[model samples]
Target chain A: MSNGAVILQNISKSYKTVKALTEINVSIAKGELFGFIGPDGAGKTTLFRILTTLLNPDSGTATVEGFDTVKNYKSIRNIAGYMPGRFSLYQDLTVEENLSFFASIYNTTIEENYHLIADIYKHIEPFKHRKAGKLSGGMKQKLALSCALIHKPEVLFLDEPTTGVDAVSRMEFWEMLKKLRSQGITILVSTPYMDEAALCDRVALMQNGHVMTIDTPNAIINAFPVKIYAVRSNRMFHLLNDLQSIPETEAVYRFGDVVHYLSHSKTFDPLSITRHLDSLSHTEITVNQSVPTIEDSFMLYMRKSDKFNISQHDN
Target chain B: MTTERPKVIEVKHLVKKFGNFVANDNLTFDVKQGEIFGFLGANGAGKTTAIKILCGLQSPTSGEIKVAGFDVYRQTNLIKRNIGYMSQKFSLYEDLSVSQNFEFYGGIYGLSRKQIKERTSYFLEKLELTNEANKILKEIPLGWKQKLAFSVAILHHPKIVFLDEPTGGVDPVTRRQFWEMIYEAANEGITIFVTTHYMDEAEYCERVSIMVDGRIEALDTPAMLKQQYGASSMNEVFLRLARAQSAEQ
Candidate 1:
């Protein structure tokens, strides 16, 4: 059990009629960067709250760094730094004051754990005098992260930390996380962004309170069953409808300028679709076999689960 | 796709300032009718300030701006009436039921009772949420709530809709679905002026403008921006521009 920094076994939680989590089991090894990838209502926040000792599961056992979340709630609180989805820092207080406050609560000084948060803190250090509320989205993210790490906890739990941040800042934040992982801090982060799944060492795709799959991002992507093709035409609006009408096209979704056509048959030829679009008078048609991304795999898994739910309902 | 779509939004030499800080510096752009214009920038790069000015929420320091052919300075009321807006924090009453939220927003836009009832049913069926019409807004999934908020924002059939990071925290599937709705609205000849931090989402826009340090660094279609910057993706293009600005700073 000590092999993993965090462990959950048969964890189930519910609120009245809604099942927040169902038979959930996951493990995060020491110093590993783990990601919970799902939508907003996918029970990510509930699981995070339980693991941080703010909420207890109705059934099953959970542990953080060898301490039971329920039995050793106090110990878990002391050793785990949790940055909730919402900005939890004092709005009226300045950045430096907030850092000092969090450090103080852990019975430590900023200087005592400065090394742990120095990478992230340095970005927001210039605005140390500004109120946390006055900072921009990206700056606030950094300040909140700095406060979370101010206590030098063994594990860091961040809930959608990079939400609403600019692309550049999001890339920088992930870099900072990788650096933190190098320093041997077990990080469990949750985000709704499928692109972010690739940044994690391993990610768990959760939906409707169930874990669909957990593996390295590469493995998850490679396991996509269907062949995907990226199709482009001058008239993108009409191209979508045209591709959907093709019998071979099983799933089609717009990805930026191109429509990703996922065919059910692995041997499906993409040229036939191009010819079909061309026959529809769609000009500048281009079709290429595309590699499946994390989002593609996630959507496939979601569709599979939806079928399962529908069959169960019919029964 | 056509260049003769008639400019829906025109801005020239637009500038906004707070004390000594210039938030929007001499920005010039024209958004064509039925176009999805992506307004992209880093934090504090003047995107929000410029959007507020366009929305007539704040008077610009200096500019010649026309939204839907109404002068921003003199016809602010007219501009407000002809436009819709949704912010990062979804503009919906969480305690209100889905149908009730629709009715309330429709009322604010001066919709008649009959019109509200008709449109409420239309949107609910379109979103496949007729079964959950009476459910409180907070009880629905984030994706559904976002689509509802967007539907309500456009209930008045505004000529233009300004979305401020509409897909900020939603999943990719939902984000894709939301874009489909936007495309449907755009097809109906409604101009979409969206500001987002996601560069990939920027690629969805017909044209995108990158703002840096209170000024536009680049503006073009995503393909052109990538080619101009010698980058593979929009994310790299944004990073190149943003990092260059940071290096200079």
Candidate 2:
């Protein structure tokens, strides 16, 4: 983690008895477009809060830009921009007002760093006078990014920045991130969108308060240890249920209009599965093998890691 | 979905102003009957403001707008009864049970008791939420809540249903299922007026209009928009457009 702008070692946080983070270890490289990919309550927000110095980790040590997360909270906050998962911008303030307010809080003015946020700021400048609450999803996102970049932070933590934003704005926001990263700002974004996992230079896969894997998106997808298939038919509901009940099925779940399943019995035949279901009055049966995605990898790891955790506990 | 579909929603020279700032500027568009029309824009581009005007929630500074054969300013109540709306927040009472929320929304829409009962069961069965009807709204998962909200919005059989970022934080699997439900709704001849930030979701719309600086920068089918912007995905088109728009300023 010597090259890292943010580092965490065995950081754990819990709310009462419910553990939100469990001994997490990770390092985010400087000027890297890193992503935290996980589901809700997977402790992504918790981990981010600790790194951004918004919330203290219950245990272990963390650092941002070589500054201890606890000992140098102000120093870290000064250099790191954080866009929370929720819509945290001042709703009453107009777009420009929110930007100026955030810049003021960080002891800067929009003009001082206008070049840093110009790409995003220009989009919201016309609405600079429009109340934040009245702005649309995409507008709010641009304004948030503008505020986050006003101080010219060395690192940026975008907690699902694309969430609640329109498809077009979501895309544009990532591009802005790329441009900012080119300026040597380390960016760490978290998103529940699997397709977006491809946008990051690297990602940490999280589930159930634990880190499953962290690597390049391509490498993670390549490491998927099973043959993935998208089994589909006209009777999607029936096909999903029957696929789940198959004896050879290791894991069967509905993904979109298709049933995505991994085979425990490697010799399991799609024809037989389709035939067996077709015989049971399934309609328009169609089954074909498909490539594995990050979502599939996450599910596979979730299952294997659940067993691994139990085994480790037994020891 | 409508073979002989008339323009259900028409907006010509639509302009909405909040104080002196122009939110929507000389907007023009038409939503055909049964078409899934996507209102797309970067944040603060005024998609929601335009939507609010069309939905009769906010008054437009000036424009010729007709929804469901009624003028937006002169006959808003008639338009309200003929259309359904789902906000980004997804209007649902957390304390109310799932079924109770359905009843509440349905009653608010003026559905008779018999209609509410029949529609509730049908919707619950369709979404597989019948098993969780007794559960409180907050207890149900976000994905289920989204599905239930879509269900309740259409329970009265509105001619058009407006969905604002309906699948914001749900997982891919759930979001995909949610789109399937949208497809089913569109198949039922329901015009879907949706706003989304996801390129994949935007691709599902029959046509999408990209707004920047209170104007329609681009408006066409997803494929056409992508081709015009010389990008691989709708997301890329958005990035190029936003950057270009900002560079001009």
Per-model chain B TM-scores are 0.98, 0.96
Q: Candidate 1 regions off by >4 Å?
A: A307-315, B1-3
Q: Give the per-residue lDDT digits (tens) of candidate 2, residues B138-170.
A: 766665677888988899999899998887766
Model 1, span A1-315: residue lDDT tens: 557999999999999988889999999999999999987668999999999999999999999998999999999999999899999999999999999999999999999988888878888899899999999888888898998898889999999888777777788889999999999999999988888999999999988788999999999988888788888888887877788888877788887667899888767877899789889999888888889988888777766767213111110
Which parts of model 2 have CA positions greater than 4 angstroms off? A1-5, A9-23, A39-42, A57-81, A86-155, A165-186, A193-196, A207-210, A225-315, B11-30, B60-64, B212-232, B236-244
Best by lDDT: 1
Fnat across every predicted model, in order? 0.73, 0.39
TM-score for the first chain in candidate 1 comes to 0.94
Please give the clash total of every predicted structure, in order.
0, 9
Provide per-model DockQ scores: 0.55, 0.21
Best by DockQ: 1
List TM-score per model, in order. 0.95, 0.73
Per-residue lDDT of candidate 2, residues A174-215 (tens digit): 888889989999999998777788899999987657888999
True lDDT of residue B127, candidate 2: 75
